[model samples]
Target: ADLQEATVLTATAEFLDDHTVRVSDNSGQETLIADRIFINTGATPIWPNIDGLLASKHVYSSTDLLVKDKQLKELVILGSGPIGLEFASMYAQFGSHVTIIDKSSKILGHSEPEIAEQAKNDLEEDGVSFLLESNLTGVNDTLNGVTLTI
Candidate 1:
């Protein structure tokens, strides 16, 4: 609520010194300098370097999936991390055929082994398919759906 009432400045910030920084917008406005500043940058999805992946119209990031309100029939997720697993579970519950592919042998490679295994089992029981120890080599956009090469 407090943030909504505050005046927001959309600008690029550049550090002038150790304690000062300059903020300027695209419009030829005068740059404002602040003695103290806090940086709050958000995160973006890092796509892998794969042949014809970026050019495909069917490809979507985790962020993209979140904001999309349309229902999907088939979804082929390329990663088995938290984002991929969560989306798989959500989409499966919504009646979408979800397929998750990962290069690692196990799902949730960064989490505890037992926990990851349990989660993977739960997702599988919910009708989400897992393709482990596989790498996505290519992606092709089809008229009906996107085809992924694993």
Candidate 2:
């Protein structure tokens, strides 16, 4: 295979020059300088610039939720994009009360209306709630859980 001759590294990379890069993992025990590099732009969670969101200890990114061991009783998601809807469906199946709040009036805005409606109905049948055309103004960490000001 083409990758048989490749020296692959799973680490953070810093471009030192046009053809050179320095790569190291969190341990900092091993570092490598490579003249040739192939970039794989993987998905990363983005924290929106919403008030009290970054400061709240009760909030977790999608990445954090993926590795989380504790089961949640209730969940609130901020988007209706593919990734968000996928999470909503998954969490709802897990018996978590899932709510998705989006600024848009409809889910799957780019897809056909019929298909979108069916998807929404399917999610709703599985006990997922949608708050359309709503903006989350802030997040507050409560004694019980998190509260969103919409």
lDDT of 1 by residue, 33-60 (tens): 5553434343568799999899999998
Error of 1 at 52 (Å): 1.0
**Which window of ten consecutive residues has the lowest lDDT sum in model 1?**
1-10
Query: TM-scores across all candidates?
Result: 0.69, 0.69
Cα lDDT for residue 6, candidate 2: 38
RMSD (Cα, Å) for all candidates, in order, is: 10.9, 11.7
- What root-mean-square deviation over C-alphas does model 2 reach? 11.7
What is the per-residue lDDT of model 2 for residues 11-68, given as tens digits with 9 covering 90 to 100? 8877777666767787673445555433434366778899999999988888888887
Q: How does residue 9 of candidate 2 score in lDDT?
A: 71
Candidate 2: lDDT of 70?
80
